[model samples]
Target: MTTALTLTAAPGPDGVIVLTAAGEIDMSNAEAFAEALTSAVTGATGSRLIVDLTEVHYLDSAGLAALFAQADQIELRTGPLLAPLLEVSGLAELTTVHQA
Candidate 1:
């Protein structure tokens, strides 16, 4: 079943693009997540895109794959609980990850 996911892309301070996501990110909604990331990345001007996953409770391989696809164009901000997943997946190595 598909879970509830909220994606909001907005401009942050210093002309940064911020995509704030909330809820579970699994196979069911990974495509939508990927599309949002793509849209945010493509629409980004000259600044970096920050993907905030602090409120995301769960993420699966599909979700990770989506993030990996845009690793070069986005940074990640997540809570302590999800930090290890990002690190273990090697996504942190490819892109910046901030634990909050």
Candidate 2:
């Protein structure tokens, strides 16, 4: 069964695109997450893409992979709970990760 996940997109300061994700992100909903991210990126009016993961309670490998697929074009803002995991997974190197 697919887990509940919510994605919101909006324009940030200085023309940046911010994509906020809430709820859990796992294999069941990774594809949806990817599509949302892709849409946000494609429709963005700026070169910077910020993915806010502060409200996300959980994320699995599949979700991580989806993010990684767009790592080159995105920056990530994460909560303390997922900071270490992102670092250990080397995602921090692939993209900018701001820990909160």
Candidate 3:
């Protein structure tokens, strides 16, 4: 079954583009996540993109892959639950990860 996922992008106060994701991120909706992320990154232009995943309750490998693809152009903000996975997946090392 497909889970409900929401992605919204907007400019942050720091001048970075913020992509906020809510709900589960798995194979079912990974493509949508990737597409949204890509679009946010592209729109960032000279600034960086900050992917905020604090409201996300689940994220599978497919979601991680989408994140990896844009690692160079983005930073991440996640809750404690998903921070370890980011570290173990090596994504934390590639970019900044702020745990809240």
Assess every candidate by TM-score: 0.96, 0.94, 0.97
Query: Where does model 2 exceed 4 Å of error?
Result: none
> Candidate 1 residues 1-100, lDDT tens each?
8999999999988789999999999999999999999999998967899999999999999999999999999999999989999989899999999888
Clashing pairs in 1: none
Best-matching candidate per lDDT: 3
| lDDT on C-alpha atoms for all candidate structures | 0.95, 0.93, 0.96
- Candidates sorted by TM-score, descending order? 3, 1, 2
What tens digits encode model 2's per-residue C-alpha lDDT throughout 66-97?
99999999999999999998999999999999
Candidate 1 Cα errors over 4 Å, as ranges: none
